[model samples]
Target: MADELELLRHANPVPVDGPHFGDGPLDHHAERHLDRLLRERPTISAPSPPRRRTRLAWGLAATAVVAALALALLFTGQTTAPAVAAPRPLLVQADSTPVPLRTLAERAGAAAADGAPKLRKGTHVQTWSMGMSDDKPPITLPEERIVRWHADDSHTEIVVATDPRHPGRPVLGGDGELVADGHVLSRQTYPPSWSDAPPQSPPPTDLGRLRAYLQEAEYSRTALNTGELLHAVATLLDTWTLGARESAALAQLLADTEGLRPAGQVTDRLGRRGQAYVYDGTGSRQMLIMDPATGDVLGLETTFTEAEPEYGVKAGDVMSYSAWMR
Candidate 1:
């Protein structure tokens, strides 16, 4: 894999005006100094594109001037960085005997009656995922990720891929480079967007208001039916730290939603026993496992119930499965 730090440096650049560097050859001593500065300070400001006149002024000796400009830009704070891409959303699937939705909702509501744990200032989630490739013996590219989101909208995440063939072994990148076994393979931190204000409180817990809130929030950008709504709700729960009221409200909303059929009881991938709920739609099945007593979601799994030979995935093949914990 590419060096994570190198990628980060390229992603965060400082904006500057004019051609700060001239065309003259750089002195070896100056070059060494620039290299040392870069090594010691990874967060140097980036230079902006030079104007036509400025470029002409720099002439053919721009190479030497570039080193000096680098130093100047590093001291000046004219930086402009690119936005990081949002994390991929989770998918869902299931196949089992169907349970009454109300029963599950009531259980969840009862659990909520005890009140939710105190909400933290930031969102923190850890997940383990498998099934990305279709190798000869079926490679389940097992990976783990930890994501954190601060109230300011800034975020950080670390992802590690493990060798599926050898449990606990770190997988080597395509270039045959290996991060020390059990070490983080990649990490990224994004600065917050000052324009976006932080939310004053958690999502509403009332059924009506919660539904409306979701519709207004970006979460409802795509039209969602009952089953899809449940899946989205599960995703929200995974992404945010909700209080007991919010959790119970969500359960009640799901209870009232149409198309949710219980898939009996089963132990989730995390070995937690919970009631299984399945939603079938257009060749795909989504299953959610939740604690029967606490209403806390245990796991989510999505499977292809119909064949799609073009993708090399057969019917009943797991599309993706994720287990999240605090």
Candidate 2:
């Protein structure tokens, strides 16, 4: 028993004594993806484990944890990726008038009345996140993931390390090497499932129910902060492609939210246009990108609005960004 407990002692990659204790790797998306798969229908959703700090790192620790210490072994061997700085902020139109979240919510509610789409259960997403640590330098990694669910409650997932912004350029690989050709890191299928949880089960479409659902999904309390709400949004979309009523309800919920504000229009990293919404948190800033016409979420970006010298994160540096593609 002592030996077994000793083995467990080394399992914690983010030790409390470590510089980045309590921080999570870039919204904890990778682990969320993994747990989703293990639950029978693997889809990227809210992370189930210890809820991380608001100033998310997305560092080497999560990579190792998600890969079951494959990167951990490499990390101990000092084979981690090269240090890369954060990317530039998404370009927002400086002159555009601010649009209130309520207005968009109303537009979405109207659109839903016309005819709501019963979206499938899955995710097609693109993400760029800066992974940082006290020991290793920050590197911005880009990848795309697609997850689909079948009638049997089975699901499929595929992750490719490529960025559409600069195709054919040398991209960073998991082992911290640069590969000229982007390749698939993983392709997997999860057989029919563990439990019918909040995310795997279709999300509730009613406004009141949806709020409760999100709170439950993220293991959060009733009064979630700006960042946590946005996290819930990303995780929810990761699990289900919201239909008309759900989208409308979500828009209204966000509309009623207090801290969210419109920051004008901007082009996302995917080159598509979107309206940007900003939420300022304790030590970071989150920009939510949405399709104006449909009220569909396009993407979300988190930036280090304040510098953390301990982790080598700078103010204005992008901590992570994820795009929920249609």
Candidate 3:
């Protein structure tokens, strides 16, 4: 294998005791190198040609491409890196019979404090989102965002390009290159401004009021199904970190609502253990993870149930995953 690779490289090799480098991902930089290799091949097109010659030229061009790709795949094995946005599907297997949502809700309600906690502003979250464009490879973008309000109403927001799932490891640079972990993607401070809108404003602690508040703000309807309720939970967590009372209220609301089935326990990307509830939609499945003790939201992940060949995404590919932290 060493002799074969050296023949392909047309370069010198080190001693057998040299340090080993593992296989690397075909990132953007590697793609550029492949493009250069293909371009450097001799030109094969012509203004006009006979049918027989045209067929032969096309065949030769195809052969050249296959050979080049084979070499690239064979030799680009120096350093390991994740090529796509998500390293793997975060699927959790059920260990036992599904736990009833009502039971968990009761526990959460019992753990609530007597008084309502003050209105909390903003959120700190980490997310992995997968996206693709026409004729391009699919990529995932991992980001950590924190939006906080300060005294006098001014707010500051910070976004970092990192995936807690693979701490200290290089992350796919949304565009395909690999960047160092914890790289600061963006930071901004906004002038003092406030809004009294449903989501922008703090949520309610009463179960009835909280349900109405979530429906009107997040669901855009008076009545909600289990899936919609889960969506509302996700949307709510995007803004505020709920207090004990708020979480208890939300848990009771979900417990009263029908259709959410418990999946069992699972650890989120942030390495926090939470209970999993799944709601299968027509086109996708939503897995909502929450703290069993407090009923606060932990994470929400979506995976498509159908294949999207046009986008190079399979049925089990994660569409998006977000983990919340207090």
Distance from true position, residue 23, model 2, in Å? 33
* TM-score head-to-head 2 vs 3, winner: 2
The TM-score values for the models, in the order shown, are 0.59, 0.74, 0.71
Maximum-lDDT candidate: 2
The C-alpha local distance difference test score for the whole of candidate 1 amounts to 0.48
Give residue 129's lDDT in candidate 2 (0 to 100). 70
Clashing pairs in 3: 85-140
Candidate 2 off by > 4 Å: 1-85
lDDT (tens digit, per residue) of candidate 3 on 105-131: 777777676544434776666778775
Q: How should the candidates be ordered by lDDT, best one leading?
A: 2, 3, 1
Summing lDDT over every window of 10 consecutive residues in candidate 2, give the lowest-scoring window: 1-10
1-326 in candidate 2: lDDT tens per residue?
A: 12211221122222224332221222344444445543453353432332122232455544543464345345556443332335687878989877788888888888888664665687767777776677655777776666666678766666666665564444565454544434666566666664667776788777788888888888876667667889988888877778777778888888888888899998776666778999899988899987676677878998888888887777888888887754
Estimate every model's Cα lDDT from 0 to 1. 0.48, 0.66, 0.62
The C-alpha stretches of model 3 lying farther than 4 A from their native spots are 1-87, 114-119, 174-177, 219-222
